[model samples]
Target: MKLENYNVIGVMSGTSLDGVDLAHIQFRIKDKKWDFTILESETIPYDLTWVQTLKTAVDFSQIELEKLNQEYTSLLASIISDFITRHKIENLDAICSHGHTILHQPHNGFTLQIGNLPEIADLVQQTVVCDFRVQDVQLGGQGAPLVPIGDRILFPEYDYCMNLGGFSNVSFEENGTRIAFDISPVNTVLNFYANQFGFDYDDKGQISASGEINEALFNELNNLDFYQQNYPKSLGFEFVKETVLPIIESFEIDITDKMRTFTEHVALQIAQALPNKNGRLLITGGGAYNDFLIERIQFHLPSIQIIIPDNKILEFKEAIIFALLGVLKLRGEINVLSSVTGAETDHSSGNIYQPK
Candidate 1:
């Protein structure tokens, strides 16, 4: 299938604080069918200072956050330019960036993504599409779990699409309606603890497997009110620090024990989201690399078939979806799902910036 000029760079910085994923992809829609080829992909890890700033920015005042937003935009422009130059990319269509989500307290009717500066378009010399979640939030939506629209469009074969990145979010088609919700914390909380041991992440779930589960903490996490609140719900770092951290800190458990119990919690929550016992599930994001976590989830739901594709897909699934969202926006199609986000209506979302 062939379509008119369909190439893009998809940029994503997830809440996990892992890194920026840049995927140069070629997408074609012919006769209402969509296909894509990943021409190049790379992940650039955040510097220690940037990581620290992002982690602590939640506590900053409004002025501080404003400055940080500008600084973050500058950093994004620089990194994106480097990526484009390194790949010698040309014949470009647009750069679709899911900017680093800084503040996501959508119940207050606002959401902020920090790296959508017009300077990025000037620096990269390309059309840019970003700031995807605010409109939905304004319309009384969760302003998250936005990938479900792409899941429905691009990977319709899988009965469920689960992404385990900063957060665990699952999406699937149920009764001809697409539904999704954030299940639990993932790399965000795990990496927070892992950093104490001087490791960016628990490689292949080694640290978690070696740890013992703190039964008290495990039960507390399982019984959290959020878990029982029902679907169309989302989570952010605020939820982590305000709700999760305090609960975990109340117990005098070792770091390894905390990891173990949290891993169990994540697995159980994810397993519970499966709509059908025997349906095929496509799992992506950094959590898919956690063998121990996968073991626990599989143990919990033995009948479901869990499939993990290549490392690129696992890492850049969200980035790819952001690119698809950009395509939908460019075509003036509905990219945000009302069912997934609890919005008043399904609609296209994002702002477009053309290079000056």
Candidate 2:
């Protein structure tokens, strides 16, 4: 059946290890366009144990990773189930989850998002749509920034949609086709140093604003090979661990100085990444809350109009988009775009598992 309406719980865990984000979203087709209401949403912050586990899972042995996958999937199931029960949700068609990306190297011909096992369906007592990235990589795509398709449909008003999460990515239409790619790391790098200071994050960029930028480090960051690479490229935590961290750590600067420099680096890179042409840019994700970062971005791109949405849309936008992706998959519509992810073709990408 081609249903015109869907009520689904969109779940997500990001590279920054913030927590599981659950959103009960109601999506409807109105006049051949997509409309959505965020019925309810909350970010369930992870405890230290889980945070530590996910932090180091990228380097786990194959067998160890396999075990961790099941473990994490079980946690995901419980989290989703708890969200539904707590919210008294009764009209769910499915649970759409992004799972957590432990390893996202599409160039290496593989990518893995843990907590996407089929068992989650039965455990949560609902149909499941998940593991949305693997198939795209197999098709020779970057298998990332998958939210662009959602941006094209749900946020057609904006000329560009930029997410400032673990990694920053921007999506926009060019010559009638949608284009998007990762520009740089945001919370992923900031949170790492923040943790060293016994803080989960730099609240409102306070710690960073208190320090100074290291010019040499900032210059090297600006000239990195990744920034020179053309579109159809994406980043993962591995990039921070392998390439970015080593370079940053090689300097003997204070942690606060590193944070300050990186924050400045992020602002400049984002401004440089966008086209010189003017347009309304929608900024979301945790980074949008960093006032210092936004100020720097505004300083760099003085003419661009930046939109910071309400808290619901800002935090739950990705979750809502994943829900839309699940609905598209259910309707057999193309949820992954060739222009955005560099896939061979635009196609429906996700695995649907019926509950046992």
Q: Give the winner by lDDT.
A: 2
lDDT of 2 by residue, 180-205 (tens): 99999899899999999999989999
For candidate 2, the 10 contiguous residues with the lowest summed lDDT are 270-279
TM-score for every candidate vs. truth?
0.98, 0.99
Q: In model 2, what lDDT does residue 85 have? A: 91
Q: State the weakest 10-residue window (summed lDDT) of model 1.
A: 1-10
| Model 1 agreement with the true structure over 107-197: per-residue lDDT tens digits | 7887888998777788778999988998899889999989999899889999899999989999998899999999999998899899899
> What TM-score does structure 2 among the candidates reach?
0.99
Model 2 spans > 4 angstroms off: none
Candidate 1: RMSD to truth: 1.5
Tell me how candidate 1 scores on lDDT: 0.90
Error of 2 at 90 (Å): 0.6
Q: Could you tell me which residue pairs clash in candidate 2?
A: none
